[model samples]
Structures are given as structure tokens and as C-alpha cells.
Target: MHDSQVFFELLSENTSKEVWADSAYRSEENEWMLKAGGYRNRPLNKRAQQSNRRKSRIRARVEPVFGSMENEMGGLFIRMIGRARAKTKIGLMNLVYHLKRCASLWKSRQ
Candidate 1:
């Protein structure tokens, strides 16, 4: 929660109003902060509820992308030492992921 402001500030001007996050991000304070920042928080709830199921369904769509990035694209390890280098490595990985996704889509259209 301490670094929420920093993370929120990292969002670009074109970012959407809704922020999808996990259960760890849920809290009354965080909700107030998110609302104050003009964002609609969609963090998963810890308890068993309808919203929890909905959140899980939403998260399921993105899980495979990260799984493939880590397992197939070798994005799990950061070979760099410094923070800048680490960011660059992750950026490159994201680029590679996009390229691979494009290629897959192109092939599927054939």
C-alpha cells in the first residue's frame, strides 16, 4: 500500500479507468486511493463471493500469457544487475511476446 501512489503514477495518460488486480491489492484504504485517482478498482476479494468468481474469470484470461512468457519465452530470469537493465530486459521480453503473438495470428489466418 505504501508504494500504491508510485505504481498508480506509472500508468500512462491513455490508461483505462479500470484497474484489474489481485487480492493482495484489496483494502479500504486502497479502494479510497483508487477512487480518488479516478480509477475503478477491480481487485479480487479474499472471501468466497460472486465478485471473487468474476475476478478469477477475468484473471484467467491473462494467466496463459504470463505463463507462456515465463516458460516458453525465457522471461523468468533477469540476467541484468541494475534496475535500468532489468527494465530494459523486461521491455525486450514484451516486444518479443508481441512479435510472437503477431506471428501466431498471421499463421492462423492462412
Candidate 2:
């Protein structure tokens, strides 16, 4: 099945009320679902360069963090067996990423 089909299944799990995704996730069903669930949908605009550019400006800040996690930090695919272990692993990884980011900034400032 397409990822979008199952994407909403995890919607309730999110702590935030906003949902951001690319054009691929844009559909009438998804839009209806988001509305019904009271989520602020941040759908990427495929047309209109001006608006898309504005949207990309926000995405710019987010893409790198995921890229760094995937390439430098061994990716987001957790291999752990259970939810608790996976959460712990992800929490530690997130902590490490922040620590690494701090170190980078510290060195740059020195």
C-alpha cells in the first residue's frame, strides 16, 4: 500500500496539531481526514512558484537535520524490537545530534 494510505494511522500518535508533508500526500481523502481530525495541514504546493518558494524556505531549515541523521548518524531506520527500546534509542540519538550540533557551533565560534 502507498505510505499515504497508512500515514493517517499514526496521526493520533503525534503530540503536535500540525501536519506537514509534500505533494505526494495531497489528496481529497487526506484533506478530509486532516480537517476532521482538526490538524493544521501544511501541504507543499506543487504549483505557484512564489508560494512554493516561501514554503521551501521553511523546509530548508528542516531538511538538513533529517539528512544529517540519515547520512551521518546512520539513518532513521531503527532496528530495535520494541517501542520502549526504540524510543530510548531515538531519544539518545536525538540527544547526540544536539550535542554534536553544539560542538560544531562551539568550534565555529572559537
Candidate 3:
């Protein structure tokens, strides 16, 4: 079981109900407030089922995003310097790619 201090500190202040990752956060006090997202010993509910399905659908979209990043904009392994600079550079690249994708879709309709 993991401590709540690190997770709680990292989370945004607006977050009330903690997303139950696994058995790590399982406890009597957190049982009602926490929602488990995975298929563990924990009981299943309709909301958990829907959340799992939604995560699968979202994972499908991530493939194309990565593919575009690799094939179109070169992989994230490009000769980047430090972590801070690399993050900024990659963020700008993604922005440009998304704009181009929108433009191409718009032009295709014409």
C-alpha cells in the first residue's frame, strides 16, 4: 500500500474523490470515496465497466497520434538536449502537427 501524501500532493486541489489505482490505496476509510479502475479483487460496478471501455477507446486514438509524431514529425528520440528544452520543443511540434492535420482535413472537403 502506498502513502497518500505523495499522490495527494501531486493531484490538483480540485480533485476530491481519489481514483483508486490498485490495492495500494485500499483502506476502510477510502472505500466509499475511491473508485477502482482496474480488474482486481475489488468488486465491479457499471461505472468501472464503462470507465475501462472508455480507456480502451482512448488508447486507440493514441496510436495514430504517436504514429504521426514518428512518421511525420520524427520520433520523440530526435537529438534533443535536456529535459526542459526537449519538452518545450516536443510541445511546439505537436501543436504544429495538430494545426496541419486540421488544415488538411478542411482542404480535403473543398
Using TM-score as the measure, the top candidate is 2
| lDDT leaderboard ranking | 2, 1, 3
lDDT (Cα, tens digit) per residue for candidate 1, span 1-110 = 55544555554443678676655667887778778988864544566468678887988987877887888887677877899998987888788888998999999999
Better of 1 and 2 by TM-score: 2
TM-score: the better of candidates 2 and 3: 2
Clashing pairs in 1: none
Q: Which stretches of candidate 3 lie over 4 Å from their true place?
A: 1-52
Off by over 4 Å in 2: 1-47
Residue 77, candidate 3: how far off, in angstroms? Answer: 0.9
lDDT of 3 by residue, 1-110 (tens): 44564544444453444354555665664454333422224455999889988997997888777888888886878576788888898888889889988999999999
Q: Give the lowest summed-lDDT range of ten residues in model 1.
A: 5-14
Best by lDDT: 2
The lDDT values for all models are: 0.74, 0.84, 0.68
How do all the candidates rank in terms of TM-score, highest first? 2, 1, 3
Per-prediction RMSD in angstroms?
A: 12.8, 10.9, 11.2
